[model samples]
Structure formats: C-alpha cells, structure tokens
Target: MVKLFNSRSSRPFRIILLVIAAIAAVAACAHADTPPAIVIAPSPFAWSVVVALVVVIIALLGVFLGMVNKSLGKSVQIKATVKKTVEDSYARKIRNEYQAKQALLDKKIEQVRQRFTMVMIKVKNLLDTLDHKELFNAISNLIEVDIGASRYVIFLVDPVKHELYPFRWQGYSDSAVEKFSMSVENAHALTYALKRKQTIYRDAATSDIELRKLLDREPLSNMLVAIPLFGKEKNFGVVHIAAFADGHTEIDESEIRFLSTLPTFIGGALANADIFVQTREELTSAKQVTEHEIAEKRRLQEIFSRYTSAELIESLLRNPEKIDLGGVNKTAAIMFTDIVGFTAFSSRMNPKEVVILMNEYLSRMTEVILDYQGEIDKFIGDAIMARFGVLSDLPYPAKNAVEAACAMMEELELLSSDWANRGLQGFNIRVGIATGEVLAGNIGSSRRQEFTVMGTTVNLASRLETLNKELGTRILVDEATFVQLPRGVKHQKRENVRIRGLDTPVTIYEILEQVKSAKIVSIQPKLDQLASRNNQSTDKDALPDTPPVAGIKRPDN
Candidate 1:
C-alpha cells in the first residue's frame, strides 16, 4: 500500500480510499440518526463514536493532503532536475560546436600566416637575385612550393615577337618546353589572363575544346591556373600552374588568392632586373664612347699641334664646339709668309739638303707665328698661311699680326746667322698682314678636310706678301692692319697698289719693327669680356667695330 501511494497510480488509489472513508462515515451517521428502539437519551459513547469517526475522517484527509503536497513538491523537484539535465546537455553541445569552429578558425589563421611567411621569403629571394636566369629559377621554385603546383611554367612576353616564351618551368621536358610557345594575339587562357591582367582558373574537364586541345601535349594533370604577371607599367608574362587531376592535390581559394598576389612581386622583380641590365649596358656604352672621344681628341691634338699654336690647340680642345665644320663669317687678321728665292735655292741644293734647310726655316718661322697665338692654317710648300683672331676673337689681332711679322723677321736674321755659321746659304722671308672679314672653317671634301680662311682678306694678304719682294721690304700690311698697329710699332705708309683679285688700288704700309721695350698685355681678360658680350649676340655685326688689340698701345692718329 505504501509503495502504491508512492507510485504514479497512487493519486487514484488515495482518492478511492477517501471515497470509501466518506461512505463509511455516512453510514455511521445514518445509523446514529436512526431512532434506536432501545435508547431514550443518546448515549455518550455513541456521541463519542461519532466524534471519533469525524476525527478519523479529518486525520485521513490531513494525511491525504500532506501526501498530495509531498507529491507536488516531488513533482516540482523532478521537473527542476529534468530542466537542469536538459540545460547541461545543451551547454555541452554548444561548447563542442564553439570549439570546433574556433579550431577551424585557428587553422585558417595559421594557414594565412604561413602563406604570408612563405611569400615574404620568396619575395626576398626574388629581390636578391639580379641575373635573369637566377630570377627565373627563383620564380619557378616559389610557384611550385608556395602555390602547391604539381607543374608550372613561367612565360615571358616577347614584345617584338608578340608571343609568350617560357622563361622558367618545371615538370616539362626541355624539348617540349622549347617547342611550346603561345602567341599573345591568339585567344587562349594565357593570353586572356594577360589581356585582362588577372588570374584565370581553367578546368580541363570543363574547359573549351580549343583550350583542351592546346593543353593535350603538356604534362598537365587537369586544372590550369593562369596568373598574369604585372609590371609597373605593363604585363610581364603569365604564370601557368597545372594541378588537380589527382584528388589529393587541389588548389583552394586561399591558394588561388596567394597565387594572385604573388605575381605583383614577381613582376616587380622582373622589371627591376631588366632596368638593372639596361642601366649596366648603357653605362658600358657611355664609357666606351667617352674613351673613344678622349682618344680621338688626343689624336686630333697631336696632328693639329703640328700646325697651330699650343695655346690655340688647348683652346680648341677645351671648347670643341667652337670647331664647327660649317663656316662662320668673322673679322680676322690674315698673315702670309713666304721664303724668298725658294725655287732657286732648292734648284742649287740636293733634295735631302733642300728638305733639311726648308724644314729648319719653316720651323723657325712657325715658332714666331705660334708665339703670337696664331693658327697656322696650312703650309703651302715653302709658304705658310697663318691667321690671328680666327679660331678665337682677340682684342688685338692686328697688333698681334704686326708683332708676329716683326718677330719672324728677327728670328729669320738669327737663323741666317746660324746658317752662315753652319756653312749653309742664308734664307730671307717676306710677311704680309691684312685685317678684314673672311669665312673661316674646315674646308675640304669628306675624305680630307683642312681648316682655312677664305675671302678677299686672304687674297689681299697673299698679294701683299708677294709684293714684299717687289717693294724691297721684309713685312708689309694693308691700311686696315696699319691703322690698328700699336703706337710703338715702326711702320710707314706705302704707295697705293693694285693687287690680283682686286679692282681698286689698296693702300699698304711697311711694318719695320715693334718696340722691344713694349710689354705684352695678357689676352685672358679681354677674352672673358668678349665671351660675355658674345653670349648676347653671335651676329658678326654685334662685335666691336674697331676694337684695339691688347699688349700694345694704339696710335692716337
């Protein structure tokens, strides 16, 4: 019975017991209520029996109530326990899910970190490699390892050929690789990637028939990934990776993303390498050109020094731009000197002796001309044509010409004395100077060019030089040169004479000598002044009309 009360069926059982107790109490009340034949006054015991019956009923009710309350409490406790168990189960399930997701997230993070590290290392290697071959090798290794590619080929665009040629590759035979070339003009995956400047993912199984046919000869498993290598300005090439025919090797989204990013570094490295190579080649070429120029300058100096003054040669070398092949019209002092009686002198002497004497005479005269900063235009047999203020503008070209002429006369006298001492015939030289405008520049054919002056001034100087023999004078000058002569120079006006190539008579002057005590003014300051003024205008008329020569004072009248 106790077990029955404790069981789930106990509620109905207790209710049946309560209903039976009520019926028994009602029967006892009915009996008591009935008029008993033997009783006049209600017996105390009867009342007490009724009271006891009532008390028993109340006690049973109380016990049943208490049992009901206890059942309710037990039911509440059971519900609480069941709810706690459900909450614990749910928490466990939730914890497991959280842990799973967290683990997966951590794995992804680690993968990203690893990819980053690998990319950094590969980029460093690419940067360190300067040579093209080494750079290609590094790129191949980077792709194969970092991208988890089974086979890969790096193709560089041949801009001229309009094609893509493999620069580096793996998992392909040399012959196959060499034979494999794709025209960028063709419509294909590689070209598409290059044209779009993006990564292209192609599945051989689903790819177009044309693409599949193109890949049939290659050692590709099934999948192809074409990543365009971008440079700073243009596309360098494409990196083609073959993979995924086998189930074990697959390219995930992460690897695809990595591959996409890798081309930037690769392209930059390639561009930098190309620039380095070009710069090196350019520097080498420039060095060769500079060396050649130096050597040519040396050769030119050696040859030119044999004719012109050292100072003139140095100036020309310093400012090579001054020696333009195109002629320029400028006012210059032209001087000509000739050995008197040279034809007769050579006729009497043997060929070797004639050469030796002529060389000695020319050498002495050349020394005097160069001492005055003159350019020996050319040596015509026994005659020398020299110029002052032709290569460079001089403030005192006329004075320099006159001084040079006088110095040559003195030098010839010394040579004559030397030749007399040596038991050789003494020689005489006549000089002529004229100041006027002339065309000065290199003049000749392409094969052989000579720097000389041409114009009326040159003709007049030559004619005056020949006139010296007729006038019985050693040095003769035109009026233009005489007016510019220094005050201390000994000169006299001559009768006007007509010369070859001139329709009018030309006034001449004989330059006897220059004052030995006169001091030579440095030409550097005047050259600087002239240079500054010439910068404003290069026209011939811009020059001073009658600039006096330096190193000597000009005559007042």
Candidate 2:
C-alpha cells in the first residue's frame, strides 16, 4: 500500500501517514494505564463508536480524493479542448490568408495577360500599315483610343532638312500643333528625347521642366511622354502623348515599357513607306520617258517618210537599231534625172521664174518617185538622184525604176505645156538607170550626214544620163537594169555605149511609153554610128525648140 500510495498519490499519502501515527500514539497512551482485558471488556461499545468514526473519516477522505481526481481530469480535458480549438482557429486563419493571396495573384496574372494581348494587337496594327499617313493614323488611334491618351501628336523627320515635321495629331488645333513642333533649337521634350535617344516624360518620377514650360506657353496638356523613333541609320522621328483620358496623373511602368517598343515598329514602317513611294515614283518617271521616246520615234517616222518611201520609213522605225549608220554593200537600182539644160535655162530666166519652174517640175517628179517606193538619194542643183532598192529590199526594183522614170517624163510633158502657156521657157529632163552592187548608208562627218548609195553603179547611172544627149533619147538604162525589167515592159533598145567607170561597154535601152494593153512596143532604134560626145557641148549655145516628136526634144549630135 505504501508503494502504491507513493506511486499513485504522493502528497495525500504523506498527510494520511502523519494522522495515522498520531492516532497510534494516543491509543498506546490510553491503553498503558489500564489492564488489557478489563479495558477491552468495558470499551466494546466505545470501540464500535470509534471504529465508525474512523471509517467515516476514511470514507470522507476517499470522496474528497475522487473529487480531486475528477476535477483534475476535467481540467486536463478542458485544456485539450481549448488547445484544439485554438489550433483550428489558427489553421482557418492561415487557409484564409492563402486563399486571399491566390485570388489576388490570379487577378494580377489575368490583368498582365490582358495588357500583354492588348499591346500586341496595337503593335500588330502599327506593323500592318505601310503608308506614312496611315501609320500615323494607326499610332494616333492606338494612343487616343487604345492606350487612352487624351492628346497626341506624331512627328516624322525630314532626312534632307534634318528637321521634324508634324505627321499626325489629335486633340490639338493647327496653331497649337505648330507651337509644339520641335527642332534642334527647340526647348521641348521631343528634342531631349532625340538627343538622349531615349524616352522623356513629365510624370511622377520623371519631370521635363522645359517641356512643362513649353506647354505652359500654350493651352496644352501637362502630363506628356516623348519617345524617339530610332531607325537603322538614325532617329527618324518622335511621338508625343499627353494627358490620360481617365485623368491619371502618372504613367505606369508597364505602359511605358510597351510604348517604348513603338519606335522600332514605326521606324521600320516609315522606311518601308519611303521605299514604296520612291519605287512608285521611279516607275512613273520611266513610263513617261518610254511614252516620250515613242512619240519622238513617231515624229522621226513622219519626217523620214517625207524623204524616203513610206514602206522604208516604217521599216526604219520598226528596226532602228538594225539601221547601220556604218555602210553596207547592197544590190540596188539607181536613177539619175537632170534637166536637159537647167544651167543655161536658169541664166536666161529670172530667179523667180527659175524657182517656179523647178518647183513645179521637181514636185511632179518627187510624187512619181515616192509612189513607186523610190528613195531620193539627193538633188544635184537642177537634178534628182534617187534609188529603188537601197534601204529596203524591192521585189521588182528594175520594174519600179522603169515605171517611175516613165511617169516623170509623162508629168514633165504636162508641165511643159503649162510653162508654154504661161509664156515661160519649157523644160525637159533626161533619166539614167542602172543596177549593180553599191555601198548604201549614212555618209559624211559628224556634223552633216546623208544617206545615199556610193559605188560604180551610181557613177554608171550618172554617165548614162549624159549619154542621153548623144543618143537623142529621154530615158536610158544600162544592160544590167534592162534585163531585170518584166517581160511586158515597153522599151526601145539603144546603141551599146561605153559608160564611165566600166571595163566593158554595156548595151542601153530607152523606155518610151507603156501601151494601153500593158505590153511593151520596143524597137532597137536605127541610128548611124555617132561619135561619143560630151553632154556639155550639146547645148552650149542655145536651148532646144518646142516639144519634139516623142514628148522629148533632142538636138542633133
């Protein structure tokens, strides 16, 4: 029991021991004065009473200890419950804090995402447009409509002038905008931004006193931002944004960061716009030059047609590059026609009369030559030097030459009659035709050039014209040309003559007139052998009489 009490209830066990020891001493003292048996016999009743009292006292102590144990257990249980409730309250508080932080974090993340997306769309719009004005308008819309800036202006640099020019703006009048424009000498935020090649602002942390002072001079917003546009080469321009629409006093760091990227996009866009404008202008200028060249070529064609055949003019125009100003040898038929005695006739008549007669005669002759697709090589005083197959290939050059020569003679007859009726001295011309290889191209120095044929064939044709005076014929042709004529050509064969510049004598023929049936009535003229005389002596003293027999008057040689 002592071990149990010592182990279970140490303080209560000590109190019980002290009381039990005192009781034992009192019992010993009372029993010492009397005999043991006699004392026991007399105290049976008293013993019962004493036993009951002791039992009552022990029971009361047991009840008190039980109450103490129960009370102590209840106190321990209450402490445990309070501790659990406090822990639960702390856990609830921590959970609430965690949830509130998560909600706040989610809201921040969503706001960042939304802001990022909005900025991306604004940048995309700026990149998509290439026109200078359109790009400015897109920037304006992003600032005033997207970014919510109440007032804004876009400026672009003039590369040549090295000055800033207003590109676009919103919420500013013309006078206000002009006052706000910045240059190297200006005291504005744009100038400072450009100088630093960074952004300038008049806001919470950063303040631009110069810009504020500049704005104070005018009726403009105070809160402003100026970001310089940097290009590959240099700063292209600047953007000025001021006065938030919602009346925000300061710009957010996120907004400033987003606005900083605009210069890169806008600079590249402006460069591309410049390239497009330059390319379009170059194309327009090239188109105009091409049109002008075509017009000039047409004018040249018209002018060339007046000197050569229409077909030759068209051919020249089509292939102007192929036209060799350098000479080329070509097979051609050359015709040389001259007035029979133009020098002597002009001496006899006045200058006006000579001009009138020559104009009329040459006009008729030129018409016939052009109609037959002949190129007039040149005019030698009162003579015409023309070619049939020089610049272009002629299918029937020999035939064209013969026909043109005959037409000229016929027209000359009518002209002679007209001259006679006008009391002017009548005129006659002789024609010489030949066919052979000749050099045909532009000939002369750089200053003056003439497109003509040059060879033995040309000299032979000239000699043949002189031979007409000795032969008493109007039209004479070398044997080379006579044989190429069509079978139905009308011609009278003349004597074989030794033409200058030829090794051997060539047979010649005189074309009279084509018959009504297009058949030739040609006869080798019966003539006595005559001395080869120079044409200069044929009309040295006087001119021929009126019209001779076959529309040509020939003096006796």
Candidate 3:
C-alpha cells in the first residue's frame, strides 16, 4: 500500500540522511549540472478535454450530414423528373417545326421547276434561227423581268468592219448618259470571256472605278453577264446582258451552265450564216466577171478567125497574154497557097461574087491548114501564108513541118468533091513548102503588135509558090522538107531548080496524090486555060446586046 506524504515530513528525513550522502550527492550534482538544468514538461488533462470536445462536435456534424443527404436526394429527384419532362416536350415541338419547314421548301422547289420549264420554252424560241439582235433583245428582257434589273445593254460586232458596236440600250441614268462605245479589244472583261469561249458575270462593274469611267455614266451594269458566240475556229461576237441588279444578285453555277451552252449553239449558227452570206455575195460577183470575159472572148474570136484558123484562135483565147513582142529562131516548113488564075478570075467577077468566092475558098483552105496543125499567119487576098513547126514546145519542128505539108496535100482531095457538088470546077492550087530558119514573133510598133513570120525564108516560100507554075507539079518541096519527111509520106521526084534568092540549086519533090492519084501535072497550063475561060465570061458581060440564041463563039484558047 502507498501513502501520500507532505513536503515538510519528507524534507527532514531526506535532510538527515543527506548529511552523510548529501555532501557526496551535492558534489556529483554540482559537477553534472554546470549549464543549468531544465525541468521536463508534463502531459495536460485540458488537452484531453479539448480533444473530447472536438470528437463530440464531429459526431454532431455526421448526424447533420446524414439528414441533409436525405433531404437533398428528395429535392434532386423532383427536379430531374421536371427537367426530363421539359426536354421531351421541347424535342417534340422542335421536330414538328422542322417537318413543316421541310415541306414548304419542297413546295418552293417544285414551283421553281415549273418556272424553269417555262423559261426553257422561251429559250427555244430564240434558237429557232441564228439572229443576234433579236435573240439579245429577248434575253435582256428576260433578265430585266426575272431579276428585277433596271437597265439593259447589248453590244454586237459590225459584220462589215468587224468592229464591236452597240445594239440596244435600255433605261439610262441621266448622270452618265452619252458614252456607250465599248471596243472589244478595250473591253478586258468581254475579251476575256470571248477568248475563254465561256460565260463571265460581274456582280458589280461600278465598283471598279476605272471601268465605271469608261462606261460613261449610262447606268453601269451592276451585274453583267456575257456569253461568247464562239464557233469552230471562229469568233462571231459576244452576247452581253447588262443589268442594274444589286451586287448580291450573283450568277451561280446553274445559270452559267444554262446560259453558256446555248451560246455555243448560237455561235455555231451565226458562224454558218455569216459564211453563207459572204459566199453568196462572192459567187454573184464572180459570175458577173466570168460572163463579161466570155463575151469579150467570143467577140475577139469572130474578128480574128479571118486571119488565123479556129485551132489557133482557141489557143489565143486561152492565153491572150502569150502574144508578146519576142522572136524565136525556128526551122519551119512555110507554106503559101495562091489561086493560079486569081487575076483573071477577079477581073471577070463582080465585087460581091469575088468576096463570096474568096470567103468560100479561104474558109475551106483554113480548115485544111488547121487539120494538119499548121498555124495560119495571115491571108493576103486569096493567098494563104501558113507556118508549121513555128512553136516553142515542138522540138521536132523540121519533122512536124513535113507532116503538116503531107496532111495539107491530103485535105486538098476533099475539095474536088466539094467543087463537083457546087457546080464549079476546083481551081488549081499552088502550094510551096520550104524549110529554113525564120523569125516568128509579135512584131510591130508599141502601138500595135502583129504575129508574123519574117526573114529571107518567108520571102523564099512566097517566091517558091510562083516557082510551082514552072515545076510542072501541084506541090514543090525543097530538099530540106524531103529529108525531114518520114518514108510513110507518099512523095515523088518533082524537079531540080536554082531558087532565085539562093546560091545553091536545090532539088524539090511533089506529093502528087495524097490519097491515090495517077499523076497530076504541075498544072501551070491550067492557069492559061482558066484565063481563056475568064475572057469568055468577061466578054459576055461586056457585050451589051449579045442575042440569047446567037451562038457566041467560044473564046480562042
């Protein structure tokens, strides 16, 4: 058992014992306790009491939290029920509104389809023909009506000058009136559209100040739509639709696709029409020129046929310009044909009969010359001077001249039959063919040019025909003509003689029967025979009162 003691009772016993041990304890304590001793702290009962109070407060708080949790759960349940009900009600209302709006939008779409169909019908009316101004007026009117535009302008090209010109202008604002000229080159907007072969639209042209100035105040197109009439490698013009619609009236893809496509067809039609019109005008002018040329050619043919044969006339007609002042040296068989009794025949005949006879003989001989491809140079009275192998193209001129002479002789056979039919005997014709170099060209003064052969060769051919009367043959061909002639031609030895103008005496041959003849004499004796007959014919006319029944003595032969 333990008892509590007071401090006084405990101190005396401690002090009595401390006498012996106190001194020892005091010395050890003093040595150990040099820096001052601190007393150890004791645990407080007040702290435990404070801890108990905090625990009590925490327990109260837990109880209050439990009650608040139960009340808040009830409140939250009520609010959630109300919120869900409100959300479901709002969802139904909004859904109904959306369905009604969708139906209205569908109705609007159907109406737009109907109007677009009508617009298409009207567009077909414009495509009926490829007329520009008419189509543009219709299109601009459509824009002004549909889009509520104030003004419209159309520009087209002047076909004559190919310059851009204005077609029509509608509703002008007075502030900017008078200036409407828009050159295609100067119009960057229009040129760009045309070059691309597409449709271009500007919602606001007035916004571009520089462009507005060029437009010259006459209601600048707030919204300008252009379609290019572009064809296959051809540009006809631009179809411009100008309108004073608000800037918000922008052309969308659908409008561009519709407008630009028709322009392609329109452009092609315009191109076809333009080409046709131009071609028609050209053909008319060409016909006029050709008719005039033909008339001139026919007139020339009539006049020159007397001098040149028909074959030669055709060549001259084809290239009238070939007759130039130039000469060529060619070896030719020059032929001269003269009537043996021309002087006596002329003296016996009247002027009228002489002309008629001369024309008849000339026409017949000219045909013969051409049949042999001989070009007749000219006719000196009843005498004919023709040249064979006088050409630039014929390389074998010497050979050709012989062939022509052979053909000319053959043609003379036809005349015998013609004379029998005409009740008159054919006259003896003297033909002379000489081969030599001669100058053939259009020779004359600058005022006039005559295509004639010149030189001693021509003179020799003329003089040779006169020699035919002495040679005792129908045709006299020089040694030159005989050497060039092919063996196929029928020729016999005529005579040998010294040509008057030449130093050498050349041997000549005669083509007696071009077809088949026994032998025709040179017929120089026929010249005298014809002269005697001509005297009888002249004496009858000169004898004024010769009785019809009286036998007029035949003229002495």
Candidate 4:
C-alpha cells in the first residue's frame, strides 16, 4: 500500500516537472538570440563546454521557477487591485455628495449677496429721493426674496441727545421706538458694534432675549441682525433685520465684516442731510436778521433825520467811537425855551388848525435848534426838546444857543405881527439859560436809535424855562448862567423859586429884553418870594414845598 502511494505521488511530481520543463524550453528558446560573455579558446575548453551545458540547464530551470512565481504573483496582485478599486469607488461616491453640498452652500451664499445688493439698491434710491414718507415705506417693503427675508427696519439718528431716536421708522410700529432704545456705553452687541463702527449679527434669535421678544409674534424667530449706521464721528442710526419663517440663513462672521463700508456710506448721507437742514435754517435766520436790521436802520435814519442835519448825523454814525461817554469839563452854553399862552391859544383854534399851527411853530423852532448846534430829543405837542452845550462837538454850544434864542425872539416878534395882521392869535415865548456838565449820546437800541441828552443840568434848565410864564417874563437865567452872560444882558433880582423834586429852591433872574430881542440876566430876588409862598403852602397841603403852577409845560404830546 506504501509503494502504491509512492508511485502515485511520484507520477504526479513527474507530470508537474514535465509541464515546468515545457515552460523552461520556451524561455530558453526566447533567450537563444543572446551571446555568451567570454570566448572559450583554451586547451581545457572541455570545462567551458560542461559549464555552458550546465548554465543552459540552470537557465531553463530558473525560467520554469520564474514562470511559477509570476503566476502566483499575478493572482495576488489581481486580488489587491480589486480590493483597492472597490474602496476607491465608495470614496468617490462620498466625495461627489460632499462636493454637491458645498456647491449648494456656495450658491446660497451668492444668493444672499445678491439679496443684500438689491436692498442696497433700494437704500440708494431712497437716499437720492430724500422724501421721508416714501423712504420709510420703501425701506419697510424692501425684500430679499432669494435670502428669504421679509423686511428691514431703518432708523435715522439724532446725535444731539446721544440717543438713537428713530427719525424714520421702517417696517415697525410707533411703539417700536421705545422698544429698541439702547445705550452705547453698554457691552451689548449693538453697542459693541457701534463702538467698533461695524455690523453685528447674532445668528440665533434666542441668544438675545430682547430680540426674541421683538419678533415673538413674527416669523423671524430664528435669527436677528443689527447693523450700525456710522461713519467718522457721526452715527446715522442702526439697521435691524431678521429672516423669514421657514427660511435658513448662513450668517457667517466674515459676511458682516465687509458691510462696514455700507454703514459708512449711510452715515455720510445722513451727515450731508443734517448739514443741509442746518444750512437752510442758518440761511433763513440770516435773512430774517438782515431784513429786521434794514428796517430798523431805515426807521432810525428817518427819526434822526428829523432831529439833526444829515451831514452831522452821518458824522456821528461814521465815528461812533469818537463819542465820549464820560463828561468833558469844557466851556459850553445851554439854552431852554417855552411858549407863552400856548394852551389858551390852542383852545382858540380847531384841532386840525391847532396841529397846523403847532407844526409851523415846530418848523420855526427846528431852525433855531439846528442853528445853535442843538439836538431835539422828542416833541411834547407844542413843547420842544432842544439841548445845547451838551454832546456838542463844537466848543461853544451855549453861546451859539443864546445868540440863536435872541434871534428867535426877534423873529417871533415879526411872526406875531404877521399873525395879528392875518386875524390869527399871536403868541409869545420865554427862554432860560443854564450851563453845567451833562451826559449826552446816542440812546436806545443800536437799531432803533435816538440822540439825546440827560443829567440834572438838563432837568434844571427845563424847570427854569417852565418858571418863565409864572414869573411873567420872556426869558430867565439861573445864577450859574447869569455869571457867564455878557454885560449887556440886563436882569432883575429874583428870590429862590421852589421847583418840583428839588430839595431847595433855585435863585433865578428875569431878562426885560432890549425892547426887540434878548437874554436873561437877573431875577433871583423874585424867585425867593415864590419860594416863601411854596414853603407856607407845604405846611397846609402836607406835601413837599412847590411853587404854584401858574406856568408849567405839560407833556401832552
């Protein structure tokens, strides 16, 4: 049984060896065209012959072994290649799906950019139009259909209060104004974004409680976005937006980074608008001020034109700095005048005729006022306001006034004759003269202006003039003025006369005139008699002592 098994094994090995031999023969035949390395030219070439046959057999055997190894290597390599190909096919499938999803994401991001661009277009249009109502409505209706967002809220700023009150509220109710008030000093997202001057977006609405409540009843319950509108030192306001219901947004941090440029532009636009509004207001105010000043200047020119010569007024106006507010101790002449029986004479004429006669009287008085370098403060009907030796650039206003008054009296005499000849009632005038320091200048508003004189000296001179009718004299002179008069101005002694608002009565003089025209010299003794009567009346009337009102100029006009 052993022998039989040996025989079967031997036959199979022999058959396999024969198959190997056939493959070796084909390999040897393929290599037959190649040459031997060294020539066998030795006497002992027999060894070379033997080595060549052995080499042939070894080569044939090596080819047989190589064929068997190559077949086994081919089977192993086919199995490895099949396994690698299967793995690569599965990997390619996964890669294709991942690339497809990435492409979709990229497309969605592009769509978002397009939507933002559309909204910006609308924003630009609204800015150009500058119509508030239209701008608000357009902003409220601005849609980003591709991105699946509904509307936006646009706020215009008021930088003065350091608060963002919505100058324009889009896509929201009036109550929304109170809802979104935020302080910039805080560390919240909106405040942070404003401080950094950039756009800020919270991807999830629930991340911020206030935002969740703001859109609680709305569709944008997923996410919220807040963008600051600011540039340089100015902030226009904020723009808030949200996603639509059933929509998803890929709001990356990098997305908002580039939007900083847009807010800058918006802020610039708002700044320009503010400048335009303020400029318009400034122009309007300037025009109003100019018109008012012009009107006031015209009124003043007309008023002062009545009081003094145009050349003199122009001099005063052109050199207002030359006017000294402080009084100067210089030689001057002060004069006062009054009408006699003017009240009784006015009663004789009708109201219109009285006015005409008064105008005529004032016209004649204006001539004397100008000739004496005097200024008229105001008119009290038939009374006149003339000042001399006060605020006169001339050094001798008092003397000029005295001479003019003398000439006025002579002219009045001639006027009286003319009135009598024309069946008109004739009137007489009393004049007083005093000299003292007095303050004078342009008074009242710079626009509505007046030129006048003030001080106690002016009051005393006026009081002296009023005393004339009671003294029954044409002219009077205070003690101070009498001392400076020329030797020819005749006067009589008069006692101190009690004047209103005076602590003590003033001694005065009466001028009898030269039977033509004159100035007062002395009436001081008569003035004292009136004062004695006033002192007695003071005890009876329980009032300060004052002279009887036999002659007093009433300020009716």
Best by TM-score: 1
Candidate 4 positional error at 171, Å = 80
Model 4 ranges off by over 4 Å: 1-303, 324-334, 444-449, 515-557
Model 3 ranges with Cα > 4 A deviation: 1-324, 348-350, 395-413, 446-448, 494-496, 514-557
State the local distance difference test value for candidate 3: 0.58
Please give the CA lDDT of all the candidate structures: 0.70, 0.66, 0.58, 0.57
TM-score of 1: 0.42
**How well is each residue in 1-557 modelled by candidate 1, as lDDT tens digits?**
67868887456556756776776776566567574455445556665576667667766786887788789889999999999999999999999999998898778768977987888887887787555556666776677666667677777776545677776677778888867687888656677678878776664324566555444343323436788888877688887777532434445555555666776887888776552222222322333334445455565565476777645665666566676657888788999988889888888878988788788888888887887888788889889999998887676687788777777777777888987888888778888888888998778898988778899888989999999888898788887776555444566776658787888776678776553313323443554554455456533422233343332323333
lDDT score for residue 11 of model 3: 40
Model 4 gets an lDDT of: 0.57
Model 2 agreement with the true structure over 1-557: per-residue lDDT tens digits = 76876766456646755776666665665557663553343555664467557756965896688689779979999999999999999999999999998898777666656766775776676666544445555667766765677877776665334456666777778886776544555655566576677776666324444555554322234536777877676676777776678987566655666666666765666654432222222322333324444454555454355568545665665556545657888778899998887778899999998899888888788988987888888888888999987777775465578778887877777888988888999878888998778888778889977677898888988998998888788888876676555444567775656766777666678776443212321311211111113222342322221111111113222
After superposition, the stretches of candidate 2 with alpha carbons farther than 4 Å from their true spots are 1-303, 513-557
By lDDT, rank the candidates, best first.
1, 2, 3, 4
Question: Number of clashes in model 1?
Answer: 2
The CA root-mean-square deviation of candidate 3, after full C-alpha superposition on the true structure, stands at 31.5
Q: How would you encode candidate 4's per-residue C-alpha lDDT over 184-216 as one tens digit per residue?
A: 554455554566665656655456575444433
Global Cα RMSD, each model: 27.7, 32.4, 31.5, 28.7
| Poorly placed runs, candidate 1 (over 4 Å) | 1-303, 513-557
In model 1, what lDDT does residue 455 have? 92
What is the per-residue lDDT of model 3 for residues 1-557, given as tens digits with 9 covering 90 to 100?
12423443244334434453544454455447472475435546554464456545555665566567668778999999999999999999999999998787667556556656766676667667444345555666655664345665545554334444444556665334336544556645655566667666664445766444443322234436766766786666665555545634566544544455556665655554342222212322333334455455555454455555444555556555544437766667788878888788678767876676667777777776665567778888788888876643343343455455545555555665775687645566787777677887768888976777898768877877888788666677665555444333466664447878887665666655452311222332443354444545533422221112112222221
